[model samples]
Target: NVDKAWDPIRIACHVYIALHAEKNEIVVEAETDDDCTTALGRIRVTLFHAEANERTCRARYIVEPPPASYMRKEVIGVEVESAEIAKDRLDRRVKLAGPWLTQKEKEDWEQKRKELMASNEKVFADHLGSAFINLCALNSSMRMRVQFGNIILKRYRTEMAKPGFAFDKFVNMMGQSRTGADFEKMVGGIELGFKLIHKIHQSPDMFCPLDNMTGKLSDIKPKQKLIYRKCGNVSFRLEADIDITVRGGEYQLGENSLYKEDSALKKRLDVEFLAFNSKFDWALEIMTQERLSSNSIAIQATAQDLLSSATVEQDVMDFPYPTLGPKRRLNGKDTANIHTIFQYKLMGTPYVVQILLARGICSDVVGYCGASMYSTNWDDHMGPNEGEICERWKLGSDLRVLFPLPPSTKQSSFATGGQVVDKHEGFRAFLAAVDKVQTFLSEAVSEK
Candidate 1:
């Protein structure tokens, strides 16, 4: 019996951390899954159950509980089904009498049918009654769990208020202060586990855990994701996919800006373009001018919580760099593909990456960006116009990806919180990249 009058000391023993002193001494612990002692495993299961119950909203709060339903299915369905079976059985028995039955036989058959119907009705009623009774029991069992979970948690909190010498050693060994925060953390864990189980839905048949068993929760394994939970609210980061598009206005924009730069230099500085095509003179001129944003937007935090975690800190030391693909064709005389490992700081986070720039001025630049070999034979080459690869920048996420997150942690805050809204930093980085390419070109042009 899950009695309310149970010993507070017994409930306290169920906490796994309190068992250290008795490590050498024989003590009551969670030896079995259902053994409600302060066994760590049982506590985990209890938290799982409490969370599941909260998620499905099966167990109601004692203060203002909702109307209860058992298995949330109708019990009257059983009565209707039982009545049909009884009628079918009676009809089958009556059919055994041939078409040429005597009056006595017919009368006797009717009487027997009547007797059977009366007995069947009683049986059906009993069957329906039993189902309902069990249904109530099931409902009550879950309610008891909710009640007991709260009660035991409260009592557990009290025991941890200032743990006795018995558990002091264990608490200290674990580096726990046994503060109220620690107890609340345990409570939070139960809530988080339940929400996660509900979200993954890996455990499809998650019941009340009224039986305090694993049920379908066994399907889930311990991974980095299971240990994760939401502890904060919605947030937005800046994201700017500000590609350097070739606008019609570029034809008129940059000549004036370039003249302004040269005039400011006090003399007409000599500049020469080597190994350069004339088609991009206009784009280069326009790029010298600053880009502007005339629009403004306001956003608010959302109600949907972060799925895993919002902030994921990564370390370059922990990961090995990606494998580089071999050049499609190579020769002793051919120059190797060179990339600048440009390091820059953004919002105080330093990013060191291999920055390779491709001038989209050449029509064949598309071939390289599209993963096509520059040789006479082309197989995986996309049309030069595809992605406007030749007209604008030959670089974008499809080819030159920026700060791609680790393969894990796709999105979060329901796609609101993690690694999005990066437009401000993004455009700033884009400008930095553009400047890097420009600086390289300027140095080449200035060379005597």
Candidate 2:
């Protein structure tokens, strides 16, 4: 479908110029037959006459066959005219036949040549060099001009075929360059690094506990060790349960359980203080230094707390504890009295007990105690007691007198037969106590 005739004409013109244009000058002209339907055109080229005077010739060309060409049939008649025959055509033809440059032609060529050279020199000087660099000057309107300025410079270097160039070093230099805006670029890299570190640190598989144990007994296995995948720019510590078997016993016991139990008791003394230092260390590394925000810390803490709480619940289910109060006393007085003083009056009272219970310490006892604490105080306050106020007074007290007394008890009568509180109700009460503490802190902080 492509027309090939035009290709040869183009090639012939190029060849004529290359061969004869010593000074690299081109001259174009056209000629036509009688009907003007067929036209022939040629280009005369001349090269620099460095050794010759302005009037003398250095190199010239009347292209072979004069670089002849004809126009297509359709437009030829409308656009072209026939060659004149009145003049001494044969004589003129003979004189111009050899495709050589004459003295006068050479003089005229030299004059025009000087003008063109001057113009080109002026343009090159005005641009200060290649047009490409000028196009990328600092004030360009294009947005990409700024964003990709370094990229363009790098590409130019590659085009020039420079060897041993390091793109990362180049990019770093550009990011810190004094010539243009760079804060965004530098921050962009920092942000990317932060995200990558966080993702690697947070992935569960990064700190997997590899073991050969499988099947139903895997959960009860005695020996389990943790292995961490290699990570860069970050450090981690395992705070998880590890089960180790005793030499004489067939059973594998949770080594972490003892630690968790002791830690839990310490938690009662001050839950916030128990892991204070470690938590702060993690926050400093993962948040401030690593650029993760405080919100990330809160999320991780919530997840850990939820998981630990669930594990504690499972442990309690596996091993039940004894009920509170004397079993033989049957007037319901012993249970009622314990419930009134402990459950209602001192259940969630802060500093009453410095020891934290591992498996709810006394799960049944605490529930009864909390109920008694609430009941005794309910009539006096006519509302829920402030949990936060109590916790603050307890935890934030002087070191010498860390323990505080619970609310004073008042005598209250209860029916001989009354509905026993359900487990769900007890849990709800516990959560209420926790919520009151949280709510008070929230309000206090807001006021500040």
lDDT of 1 by residue, 1-448 (tens): 2222233435655422333344643234454545544344444444343433332221111111011211111111011122312332212100011133356655555565456445533432333233223222111111100000011111122322231322223223222223111010011122232332333233233221222244343342221111111122422221121112223312111111001112111111111111111111101100111112231132101101121112222212121111113323222322212111111111111221111221111112211100000111111121222333332221222211222222332344124545354322432343343333334333433434
Off by over 4 Å in 1: 1-97, 140-448
Local distance difference test, candidate 2: 0.21
Off by over 4 Å in 2: 1-237, 240-423
1-448: candidate 2 lDDT, tens digit per residue: 1123223434544322122246654323224232122112322111111111121111110011111121111100011111321122221111111233456655655565456445533432222122212221111111110010000111112211222333223323322323121011111122232232233223333211122112221122121222111122332222223222223322122222101112111111000100110101000000001111122343234223322222212112132222223222322111111101100111334311011111121123232101001222212211123432333232112211121222332122222364332212322333234334323222322332
Give the top-scoring candidate (lDDT): 1
Number of residue pairs clashing in candidate 2, backbone atoms closer than 3 angstroms, sequence gap of 3 or more or interchain: 15
TM-score, each model? 0.15, 0.13
